[model samples]
Target: MNEQNDNAGLFGSGDEAPSNHSNNPHFNDLVAGITRRQILASSAALGSLAFLGATLPSLAEAGEQTVASQPLKRRNRLPFTAIPTSRADTISVPPGYKATPFIPWGTPITGRYPAFADDASNSAQDQAEQTGMHHDGMHFFPIDAQRGLGRQSDHGLLVLNHEYIDAPLLHPNGPTVVNGKRVNAEEVRKEINAHGVSVVEIRRNVRGEWDVVPSPRNRRITAATPMQIRGPARGHKLLQTRYSPDGKATRGTQNNCSNGYTPWGTYLTCEENWAGYFASADADMPRELSRYGLRSSSRFGWNTLPGDEFERFDATRKGASATADYRNEPNHFGWIVEIDPFNPESVPIKRTALGRFAHEGLIFAPAKAGRPLVCYSGDDSQNEYLYKYVSRDRYWPGFSHGRLLDEGTLYVARFNADGSGEWLALDITNPRFLKACLTARVTFADQGEVLINTRLAADVVGATKMDRPEWGAVHPDTGEVYFTLTNNTARTLADAANPRIANAYGHIIRWREQSRDHTGTRFNWDLFLLAGPQTDSRGPDGTALTADNTLASPDGLWFDPDGRLWIQTDMSGSQLSNGPFGNNHMLVADPRSGELKRFLVGPLGAEITGITATPDFRTLFVNIQHPGEGSTATNLLSSWPDGPGKRPRSSTVIITREDGRHIL
Candidate 1:
């Protein structure tokens, strides 16, 4: 999640300005009109209770009432006790809850099912068959019709995103390098094979423990997998690479972070920090490449090796046209890739209509029959923009396909000081956008080019430049959208929306769509929580964040069916400085009462991300990523899951109640 510095891309130079919002005169006037005190007072007055009451549709109007809106027959308070902060290298949960490690990195799931080696000597082919590294966003699809059971929780397919890898921990003695270039071809191949998605069959055994079940459905989609490019920018000239002269295809999805699922049961894996993986020495790089932070060298020196497959990482213009070389390769990476987990033979499609720019993740609003589909995504860089897409065609139950994502109008948000916000259409035909582009002297060949340069388009239109926006969640009952602004130390201007200067401790902001319409262009927003030390932080009620609920750098966010907001943190850079916050952890918050409680804490140097649950909500799955992240081959900082003397591995943890009841 761009855990490096506020200005830098995950592994690239921070060449772009921290924020242009302060420079826009109109934006300045919007913020200058409202005082911070007024903003906070208005937000507190519209507390959680008021928020729920005002935004929720009537039961009859909404058709069916979710479990969250039912009367007092259900438990009203949070069931578990809040745990204290800890620094110990272990998983900590509240009393009556059990957390078990499962599907760790390098565990075999497909092909011959090779066993994990403690010394990390597995081959590149072995890695392609095994579970990938750094598990992020995931979903559990129940095995219902196959087992003749409706919404079965015991058996399911676990689909998760394997984000970027920890190179030092991947090999036995670490990567081999001669000079500044990577020399070991096998190491490079294995690293590329580890970055993508994994689909595995898992089931609960009679002994009440979850285990990977050998099945034909098990598969791994790595960075080298062939994928089709779809949507408005599908066959654009800018995307024409040597491998795909027609610009309709590309090789691989990299840096997959948080994910989403479609109503038709497809998985959406987002490619984040992908621009840093490409290098170009071209003097006159286009906006499509330069705007996304392309550097002179790549994070992993895969481009240093000889061969078209490895050399594609070097995007320099060495050919007469875009199709003659890999100059257009970077355009293929930063997209929301749609994967059909049920169909192993299906090719993943990169839905380019979503307007990619280091997409952190995508979250869909609840689909309704005969209504246009709506989804939201955020750019995960300092001073980047937030985006939403509305489909041109109406959605039909059991009939909708990925085509809905292909034909859509993308919009960028502009939050104002008066708590009102507008979604400015990023369409090339929009008069305001066209004027802005002309004024900035930015020319686009077509809608495809506009989508290719989404960040630049948003810049000309003057979208609100947010902090490092990471993950987003949609409340099942109220339809309120919540996004985590994972800390931005680069922020220097204080506005009503982003109310802090040098915001090291991130905050959560939420908004309800206008008139409860998911496709509405106007909305109202408020700060849900300002995370930091007890003295500086504030909750929804304007009270100080206590030791029990304080946190920093909120990253992953999700909403259970019961309306509980699950919050995860990635305090990698500040964990030592913010000692009181302890190790990375996950917490649950009651949106109705603005009450928060710490639920789970991971081992030292790990990030708590990628959360999901079974259909019955009886079992919960959470990922502990990059434990002991900065450790070297000889100087180990942590030995988690396997204890002392063993290398640390990223793994998923299963949480369940002691009494076998539903986990709340």
Candidate 2:
């Protein structure tokens, strides 16, 4: 969750059409040969479509049929050509673009922290007051009326998540461990403080550059911050802890990855891969613990340190009951935490009905006045399932703060081999689910257990095992949901959907609900893009990806207001040096034309993660995470933002067109 599993660095952080051609006759023939069972089995995978049943069309035909079926609207194309891949230690952008560094790592926000030191010597308190590290999915809340009266480009609140810490870069001596035990409490505290969300006031300067303006809005929600637990799991026994005996609250939100901003003006920062941060000492651990990938030892052994502050990382039962110690500590994380950025003092709420797992991000479906609100999320672990939450209550203008996420039904996706899928409700009352739980030997005591152990429930219900589903995005126009299945090396057998044996280079999969209904259970899905070399065979259509659009380890996906999909890459280790994919970069895709182009590239040892833009589409923001991830303190691989001799600092890049034109 925090780490990219095999790919290092701090952790953080879709679809197309069909075609017609003489060479594509095989695909067309496959489409004609599609049987009812075949259509149901592989309805989600991309291929030629023409099933006798009323299943979703193929990717090639989807765009055509969709355009033909709906009111015609002009699709926007990327204004610039694809930027070539590079090994430069700088950010590459389109020809007419200007990139400015804004709010780099350790930028002080609350004025309590001093100027950021280059030697990684900032104190724990300083870190708590400063901006967090490894900026990921973020959003810009314009400084207009509270509930979004108008867009404010010149001034706004920039809310972002600081994912995992770069231990070597954050500590003076790269984390102290003496005799197989962590000794430095302050270092661990600094790391904890660096793993949450940061809110700061940003304004455009006279020169059209964005500057961090210190204000009361500046605050950091770190690992030690207390947060209220909301939804069905609020007072559950599994959530009770010594810190919050009533089970109403708990400390911290770590591994905050991609985020979601609500129409009601709140920031939803998701907790991903948080299980790796804890160490469970007991062999007979809670069944939910191992299911979430919690283990006996962690990369940062906070449990080995002294004091209750550090001991909370030991999730094993230390006392007789859950409230006696930190047995329920891990349960507090792996949730979508909602924070009111406009009101700095507002307490963050862990929305537990979102179904806890390694949540990559949450992308809300387009809001409708009288329709139930829907939020889509993906579990980032290898072979994990995709999930979505549908609120029981309908959306209205200026609804209550936590009403949407509080009372909702959480569902896990089950993609049939034929490209069709159904959202399996996690509710135990469903008869089919009861039999599934019985088969898995999992007895659901209540709804809380079903939510706390959501992945287990998903497995019991036979959800599809994907290739490490990561970031997700909802098309503003098409109402299609896209998720990046960012590589899975552990996979051995090649399935009909995920066809690769050892899927090092990942792919993007997308789905569209019937009648564009986000709350609907049944839908059609298909592979949008396969991330790999140009020479790689195009599986079904065999012409979807090419040299100009090929990419590996697709992550950090977003759709700008104009419907341009932005893709960020995460390739590390030999993938960088051995192939044309050198360093991480960002790409832009046009859904209607099925055209993708490389828009920007980052410096050495960096993964381009977070991405956001103003409502007017003038100002764009992207994050450069862990610019020198694999390098040692003495010998660095990249020294970006500050230039060559300086230590590499992760920073956010602010971009705008020099010609003052719209981004598309």
Best by TM-score: 1
Q: What are the per-residue Cα lDDT tens digits for candidate 2 across 395-437?
A: 8877645777989888988765455678999987788889988
* RMSD in Å for all candidates: 3.7, 6.4
- Candidate 1 segments exceeding 4 Å error: 5-32, 42-74, 145-150, 495-499
Candidate 1 RMSD to the correct structure: 3.7
Per-residue lDDT tens digits for candidate 1, residues 304-342, read 899888989999999899889999999887899999887
* Ten residues in sequence with the least summed lDDT for candidate 1: 7-16
After superposing candidate 2 on the true structure, give the runs of residues whose Cα lies further than 4 Å from its correct spot.
1-76, 537-544
- What are the Cα lDDT values of the candidates? 0.83, 0.77
Clashing pairs in 1: none
Which prediction has the highest lDDT against the true structure? 1
Candidate 1 local lDDT, residue 573: 65
Native-referenced Cα lDDT, model 1: 0.83
Report clashes for each candidate as comma-separated counts. Answer: 0, 18
Models 1 onward score TM values of 0.93, 0.90
